[model samples]
Target: MFSRAIAFIAAIGIVLTVNKPVISQNHSEHHSVPSPSETSAERESSRLTESHVNEGLTKLHQKNYSGAIESFGKAVEIQPSHYLAFTYRADIHRLLKNYQAAIDDYTKAIEFNPAHSYLRNSRGVSYAALGDYQNAIEDYTQAISIYPEEGAGYRHRGAAYYQLGENEKAMADLNSAISRNQKDAEAYTIRGEIYTNLKNPDLAIADYQQAAKLFLTQSNREGYTKAINLAKSLQQQSIVPDSK
Candidate 1:
């Protein structure tokens, strides 16, 4: 489905950061607390959850997505308020095409850490996949506002604009992304598509050419084919102007 900007999607699509929760202890409270054994169990649970989170990171490195998901899920079960666990688990759900489940986990994570802009960006991607472009734009806009220097935020937002048939907005955002990140072949490719639709064959050819070169450099066979094929077609069309 996303055969065009595979690398681009991988860049801005996932939330992998683990947040360390702060637990403040109150020594002034005279009320009763948990028993010593109960405290031990709580400590054990926290330790085990940390272990699970570590194992999940290892599984992700090994490309065992399902195993990673299981580990993160276990961490969430051990501590439902574990924001990182929920965020990681939500990413797995998103990769597995479980959009609603991913949204739920992301929502829970956002509740725990509302200041993170990328969380909104990641959740926005899921919303876009489910044909919720409006929500995706909202999240992307928030992300842009939060981190104006982030090029990927603009890239994804441009794609969403293109999907919504807002070529002008899409092109503008893609231009911003490309100007900031020269190596962003995905942004070039997407902007090329926008140019093609806007009847700017010369600009499309330029973008597609750059996209193909970048994809080849990245060793992405699918992106190479997509860009090269479109570029060639556009080149041919440009060779023959329409008769007035």
Candidate 2:
């Protein structure tokens, strides 16, 4: 069963669910198997776990999030300590808008693999969705500490900081993210929002325009909509009544 589970998880791509400002986390290259010296029972258990995980992945890809959760539950039942199962299950819960469930699953996954930066970053997103900015910041910080060069963690942390009214920190993080990933449309959009809040209409408009262009290149309707709205708002704000 364990062996089957391992195979299953590996057979299907792991689906990740990250909220706004993070897009998604993909760790397709992280799959690995235990040493060959492991007992046959262990291998079987791994196989079972993999099989269920694959089933869950299939459901997730089909957008049947509830069914995916059930499949992940089965995988977890077969191997309680299976970190990826917990992470994938958490992802499904997020997709279902079950924020608490997602947090719980992410917690379990974190306990099993504390060094998994992607899981930490994803969990931070779950916390952010719940309006727990402090927790979200902590998780993003931990992920940054683990993987300093990762732009996603910093961008997420920046978003959390912005929510917490820490404009300076947010700007710094957004700048860092933009430095790391020049083509990051989300980063530009987020930075534009921060600029708007700072009352810097010129900078905000520039950033929004860049974001809209990037979104157009990527065919992201949502980003384009946000950019258009920001641009319109900036334009209206610029046309102020003259004092006689």
- Name the candidate that leads on TM-score: 2
Off by over 4 Å in 2: 1-37
lDDT agreement with native, every candidate: 0.76, 0.78
Q: What TM-score does candidate 1 get on C-alpha atoms?
A: 0.79
* lDDT score for residue 229 of model 1: 95
Q: What is the lDDT of candidate 1?
A: 0.76
How much lDDT does candidate 2 score?
0.78
- Residue-wise lDDT of candidate 2 within 1-244, one digit each (tens)? 3333333333443323122211132323233467779898987887777778778767766667778889889989988987777877886677667888989999999898898677788788889999999999999999888877767777888999999899999999989878777777888999999999998999999999999999889787998989978988898879977779
In angstroms, give how far residue 134 of model 2 lies from its true place: 0.3
